[model samples]
Each structure stands twice: as structure tokens, then as C-alpha cells.
Target chain A: MSLSDQELKHLARLARIHVEENELNALKDQLGRVFKLIDALQAVDTKGIEPLSHSLSLSQPLREDKVTEIDSRESYQAIAPQVEKGLYIVPKVIE
Target chain B: MDISSLSVKKIKQLIDSKALSAFELAGLYLQRIEKLNPELNAFITVDADKTLAQAKQLDQAIWQGESRPLMGVPLAHKDIFCAKGWLTTCGSKMLANFVAPYDAHVVEAFNRSGTITLGKTNMDEFAMGSSNETSYFGAVKNPWNLGKVPGGSSGGSAAAVAARLAPLATATDTGGSIRQPAALCGVSGLKPTYGNVSRYGMIAYASSLDQGGLMAVSAEDIAYGMNSLVGHDERDSTSVKRAEEDFTSQLNNPLKGLRIGLPEEFFKEGVDTDVAQAVEQAIQELEKLGAVRVPLKLPNTSLSVPVYYVLAPAEASSNLSRFDGVRYGHRTKDYRNLIELYEKTRAEGFGAEVKRRILTGTYVLSRGYYDAYYLQAQRVRRLILQDYLNAFEHCDVILGPSTPSVAFGFNEKTSDPVSMYLSDIFTISVNLAGLPGLSIPVGFGREHLPVGLQLIGPHFAEAKLLNVAHQYQLVSDWHQQLPAGIAQV
Candidate 1:
């Protein structure tokens, strides 16, 4: 499948990347090549096969519901690029 | 003593015998980092003071006769792991200044084992590129040849261990990130069965495929690290709670009755002739040691690259959404609205390769195209997994060249991303199948570059994988061959 220039731009926007006009053509070409390579999957008949999500078929172990507090919050917030009043600060969304 | 060249086992012995203090070893590694890291670009942050303090505390514990399994062994972690107080950038500009508040589960496990933290090693931005070129900090030069690329996302860790900068370094694999570079750099790297190591603190690449592993001088060291890293963790939903087995116990065992499957697809067209020669020689050595080469077919092997591209990016696009400018990473200096801020911040934070992946991922996962792309990729992934199960029925382990070729010259495949992606053709299927796979230095390729032979085992079969790799290392001197300057150091 070919990606239109508009579709590529929309993807870049959604991905939060700035793709220059020149680079878009290169990306388009690369994406096309990659998609073409992946298209080989279409030939395989997977009608009866179960699509595996995790590698193992093990069930999640059940445990009693419990809550414990580990006070590493102060230490954890210490590395944030920006923090304010014990909260990770971001530009106002509602305002 | 130059402790950098010592194996993890030897380091443990020294620490236990009181011949070397953990503090001394940590100091020596810190000194090496100071001296060699400038040229290698192997580290993003070197927490010298913190490391020294931890080593001192471990030394005190050793004095009290408190013995831990990996006590006093100095090791470095890939920057992708979140270590409290250390910058955990995953080699991306978006998280460049992001300091992790808590340690990843792997980091906690190492800390519990009293392993000294040397520092955080460099990697490709968000673990995207095969070469370290995609790192936002800068490209990591191969310790073997400065002009060549160190196989990457875990390139810095592999190069660091190769340069004797550290005895052990933590790494991760999604699509050949751990094993490919390990092979190219002539070291040992293992990606345990998925869920073997908890992904709690590892920054997500493709959540389904990403797994924590290690890069060391030998498979034995990988086994030791695996023993410590693997086990069920409640915090990580995907972690498997399997019975813990000693991964290194079978290192001395002969491979006489071992069935080693050699897939024809891996040796088919697209594999470099030089790499094939090295792998063939390694296989010959294994055969001499009693391994019977059985022909196996992973019929869907050719489709691995395409399937992985779709799935890895689809997951990456979603995982990376957390990196929007407003939350915990680089933010745009000026923006009129929230949307613009998000765009500007992400654009500035992520590098070219990362941006390309995110865009591609978003496109694939978008509305109206999910079935055509994302869902189809998942189905293909199952077919790939089935191919491995079918092979395992006939053979105990599968063997192949880790990459199509050894370490290429810097910027060799950068212009052609498709060619670069093909480098992972041999390694991606292991992840697809959720099986344990490892890369060990088998021999040298063109220009004396390292060639890695990949060993793939069935699910939760890390012990066997380690045993086979360790047995190979015993009879071969390839793992002992260090890069020129690394040996001198």
C-alpha cells in the first residue's frame, strides 16, 4: 500500500515528529519498501491459528488484593525534568 | 589489578577471598570509564560518587560475612533502564533530561545482588536503530574498529564490555538489539525467553518484544546475570513465574547428544558469505563436540522482517505517546496551544529515526487500516512462532548467523534503512516466538570484525541455551579475542 503525502504528514503530526519536506519523500520510499517486505505475510493462511499475544500460554497467578505503600515518591520525583509542588507540571489543558 | 578483563565469576571469587574489595573494583571501573569512555561514547551518565558509595556499603557487608550471589561485581546498565537519580534517556532527546524516580526491576535485582553500578551505557534512540548512529547523544564507535558501526541499540553496552570498560553490562532486545551487536562486537549477549526478565523499569520499545538481557565477555557471565534478572515480578504483568534453575550448571557438560538445528532459510540468499563461513566453522566445532546438525525449517523466517516492522512500530507508536512534551521530557520553549506544544516538544525531543518509526507506527495503527496492517501482523507473528515450535520438535536448539554480515562501516546502511533492517533478519524470529536466544562470538569476519553465531532455544529453556553457548566458548578462543586497544587497556 502506498502512503500519500497527506497521510504521511498526518502520521508525523500524530507521532509528534517534524518531518521535513525532503525527508518525507525518503520516508515514503522507506515505508513502502518495509510494507512491501511485510506483505509476504498475506500469503500465509492463518484462518484456524490463534493469534498469540504473549509468548507463554500461562495464566496470571491470583493473589489476595492488598495495598502497601513504598515511600520512594520523593526520590522518584527527584529526576523529573520539571516538577512543581510534588506534581509533574505540564502546560494547562483546561484553561 | 586491572579488574576490567576479569570475568564476573572471577570478580566474585576475588571479592569473596578478600583479595579485592568491591569498592576497589568499582573504583577501577570508574577510572576506566573516565579514561576510555570519551573515545568510545559508551556511557551517558557515570555515577561515580553513587557507585563508590554502593561499593563501600557492599564491602562492609562482605566484611560481615554476608555473601550474595553476585556480590561486589561491577557492572553497567544500559541507559534504557530507569535507575533512580541517574538520567534514563533511552538515548532519545525526548527523555534526555528525564531522571528516573525508581529503579527498573532489573536494576533492583542487580542492586539486591550487590552488583556495583558502573553507570548507564548509551544506546540507539528508543532502541530503534541497529547501529548506535541513531542515538541523540552521538554515535558510539565500535571498540574493534573506530571506523565501523557497533551493532546497536545496545551498542554502547557491547562496546563497553568489549573495550574492557566494564566486566558486565545490561542490555535489552526487541529485534536483535542485544544479540546482533553482541555478535558484531565479539561478545556474548543473550535475550532470555520473553517474561524471563521483568520489564518494569525498562523504557518500552515494543512492549511485546522488549526483554532485558546482558552483554558480557562470555556466556557463563550471561547465565549468572540471567539467574539474577529472571523470576516472576508482580509489578510487571508479563513476567513469568517459572521454577528457578541454575543457568550455569551445565556449562561443562558435553554437547555430544545435543541436536543442533541449522535452518536452511538462515543460510539462504541475503546472508553474507563471510558471516556464513564463520557460522559454519562454529557449527563444525559443535559437531566435533557431539552435536548432530539436523535440518530444520522456519518456513516463515523470510517474513520476519515485515511482520516485526509492523508490530514493533505499532507498539512503539503507542508506547512513545507518553513522551509528549508536557509530561516529564523536553518541552517547547514557546507555543500558543497545547497541541502545538506537544508537536514542537516531540519534534525537538525525538531524533530522525525515532520520528520516522513513530510516524510509520501511527500510520499502521490508524483507523480503517488496523485490520489491513496491525491485526494481520499479529496473525503473521503467530505463524512465525509456530514455525519455531515445529523446529523444536526435531532439534534441541537452533543455530544461525546473528546478522547477515558483521559490523559494517559507519553510515554504511544509514542511507538505506531497508538494508539496515535486513541485518536483523536472523535475530527477529526469536523474539517473534518468545524463545531464548543468544549471540556468542564465533570468529572474525572481513577486516577482523566479529561474527556472532546465534543459538535459539525453546520457550523458558535459558538453562539449555546458556549450556550450549558456554560449551562452545570452552572449546573456542573467539570470546577471548578482545579489540586491540581494549586488550592494551
Candidate 2:
């Protein structure tokens, strides 16, 4: 139920959050406690029980696959951190 | 007139009778926020000119003989719902500067119902924590006891309604956000059956469990608010399509042969004595009103917190991946690569509780642990829901203490995450079952702070829950008791 510093580092990388060396130990301790609580679920016999994905067991409702939205790129891009010529500018991916 | 004490219904009557204009009513609430918000930290964003303009427009409509259900009543929006042209922060540093270009479905519905926006209330960072302490803006103080924390992530909304800053505030419950804070701050809150309200523009935290609801001075006001909030939305796939509901239709229904479920697990060892006494007395009052109490058992109730932590975080980790440094919200100033940009922005933007959950979610859903944690929790979730399904066959509604105890002082449970999570023990199961639950002030608990009684109803049974809560409010004046200094204001 406890997370090692190396595991915590890996988790932060996977989750896309940066954790400092000092914060890692404290976070590990707290997360370890949360995991201890979650560990209790392992004891419950859920064999053959369907994993309830939705509370009411609702199947995805469908509609005709047609454009339902008005194009509002300018309105949406106005809030982006970096946008140029109506396109989002992220760090270069091409070599 | 003591405008602060008026309910949504009373506010409507005043405006309708020409005793007050919508513009004047909005001004009264705005003035109260200006006076009281400094100490309570209940409001994160308040634009007086904008609010008054909307009110003035409504007044013009009234003058032109046009009327809507809740036309002039002022309401607070939990920062979680996006309000077009308003800064919708969701109580996170991540969204601190994000001005929404569109309104959430609930926000649009409220506007369509003719309510004037008062302001956006504060909340926990991304609705992650039980106490308002995790909010990036600041923690909201309980109206009843300024020193104590307001149970949250909907703490500010609850505190605002309790302090009479707004008669009603839109709130959401992923776990117990709405009910816990309402219980702590001494107001009425209702979390309808999941998918009852659209989640189109609500900042998602645990999509399956998140539900939009209301906080108000009384259950009747909550019913009034609900009338405007429920409807199907094509945008939210999970939004249930049903016959249009009149949420207030059953408010006057007598409890002559009503069956009230008393779950033994909820009343067992851990609940504080004062809360127990208050809940017991409230139950007696319901019995006197002709309700028959049925003893019930929900053995899986003990596992709710554990199951919630696993499932909620797993969903949160996936939902929050959208917060990369690109489209909206806070972005890192220094980053060399796309991955660095993602890591740095999230690291800088999310608070500790948010980060903790993301990390926990990542771990639980990681390669080897997904089945052991995530899948197992989902199966257990069914068992938890099954417990309620069984109980409902024997009883019409389930009643219990809303929280284990009254509001605790700031920092009392903040340092320990599990203790903070346990505060939501009684309320989380209701969310897992997709059932409508309500919290109403029943009596005072420790330090003479307010205690709340929780009522759980079957799926889509919001009318029954509100009817029971409104009946209790009829016999008791607990919901009417204002915070000492606040009443004088």
C-alpha cells in the first residue's frame, strides 16, 4: 500500500505533474494513507459482479452524426495561452 | 424590509407586488456581499455593475408586463459552472484568470428562469477537498462559527446562503460537497439523482458522481431553485431524458403513511452525541407528523469512502488531462518541450489536494494496479448501490445525520487527509447510488453550531426528498436561525 520515492516519481511523470524532491516524501506519506483506505476494497469479494461503470447502468445515447455546433474558434482561442492565426502554439514537435 | 432574510418565494412576491424592483433586489444582495464578504470570504468574484445591469434589464421586462418564474431573485453561482463573460475559476489557481466564453447549461437555465446573477461563490480547488481549506482563493469561514471551517468544496455557496448574502446558490456534489457544507453552515442543500441536471459546462471532477444541486435558506426555496435547474441536455450524454418535472409539486404532500428508513450503520458509534440527539429529535418530529420509521441496514456503508477515493480519482485523472498548458487555464511561462509544458503547468496550477488525487489516480490506474484498485472499486460501488436498492424496497426514504459532527475548526482535520475524507462518510453513499439526497437544518450540535438531517430517496425521487425536508422545516425553525452577528446586519 506504500509508494516508494521512485514509484512516486514515475506516477508524477505519468500524471504530468512535477513533484519536488522535498514534496515527494510528504506526498508519498499522505498518498500511502489514502491507498491504505483503498486497499480495503481488495478484501471485498467482487467475483462475477459486473463493474458498474455508470450508476444507473445507462447505455450511451446516440444521435445523428452531424455537426451540431457553430464554429467559434475565435471565441475559444481568445483564452488560450498562445495562439497564432487561430491555431494553438505548443512547443515544436517536428525535429 | 429585512431583505437578507427573505426566501426565493418571498423575493418573488415582493418584486411581483411592485414593492421592490428586480434592480433594487439585486442591489440589496450586492450590498450584503460587499459588507459581509470581507470576513466570510464567501464570494470569489462579484461585479456590481454587471449584476445591476442584468437586474435593470429584468426590471424593464417586468415594466413591459413580461414575467418568468424566478425573475427578480438574486442567486450565487458556484465558480464550478462556467458563466459567459464572468471569471469562472472553479476555485482553482489553474482557472483564476479564465473568463468563460460560454455559459454552463445550469447557468443558462438560471438566466432563462429570470434570476439575476449575484456573483460566483468560492469552492475547493477543482472540487477535490472536504474542507474549503484546499481552495486556492482562500478558505470560506462557516457562517455559524467564524473560526470553524465550512465543509466544502461548495463551502462558499453554503456560507453565502447561510449568511443571507444570497438566498440560493448553485452547488455540485461529486461526493458530499453540497450537503456537507450546507450541513456545516446551517442551510438546505439538495443533490438530485445523478444526470438529473446537465453537466455540459461544469468543470468535471469525477464525471459519473458529479451532480448539480442547490443551497438555500429553506427546503422550499431549494424546490423553487430546482424548478429552474432540471432538464435534459443533448450536450451531456449522461443527462437523463424524462418528463418535465415540477420539483415543488409535492411540497405540501402529507406524511400520513410515509415510511422513513433509519439505517443502523449511520447511527452507530462514530457520530457525535449532539448530532445524534438532534437527528433523533428530528426523527421523532417526523413520526409525530405521521411517518413510520423502518429499521434498515446498509453494511457496505463502511466501504463508501474507500470506494469513492478510488473511483473518483481514477475519473479525475482522466478528466483533468485536458488541463494541459494549451487551450485554456494557467500555462507555464518556462517549458522546453510539450511534456515539460504539461508537467510544469499542472504542477504550478493545481493545489496539493488536486495533485494528490491526480497522483493517486495515476497509481491506481497504472499498468499492474488497474484491476486490483479501479475495477475492484467499481464492483464494490455496485454492492454499495445494491444496499440502497434493498433498503428502498422496505422504506420510502432514508434519514440520518448529514455529517458525523458539526463543522470543525480550520486545520483540525486538514493535515490528515483520511480524517477529512471521513467527514463525508454519511453522505457519499447516496452519491454512489445515484439517488437524490438533501440536508436540512434539524437542530444545534457542538458549540451550538447547526446540525443537519439527511434524507435519501430512490432514484429520481427528488420530489419526495424535498417534500420530507420542507415538512421538517414547517415544524422546526432551525433553518431560520441566523448567525448571531449576521442577523443584525
lDDT of 2 by residue, B1-489 (tens): 687779999988998898999988888888889999999999999999999999999999999999899999899999999999999999898999999999999999999999999999999999998889999999999988899998999999999999999999999999999999999999999999999999999999999999999999999999998999999998999999999999999999999889999999999999999999999999999999999999999999999999999999999999999999799999999999999999999999999999999888988899999999999999999999999999999999999999999999999997889999999999999889899999999999878898989999999999999998888889989999999989999
Q: Which candidate leads in TM-score?
A: 2
Q: What is the interface RMSD of each candidate, in Å?
A: 2.1, 0.8
| Candidate DockQ scores, in order | 0.60, 0.90
The number of clashing residue pairs in each candidate reads 2, 0
Question: Which residue pairs in model 1 clash with each other?
Answer: A76-B101, B104-B201
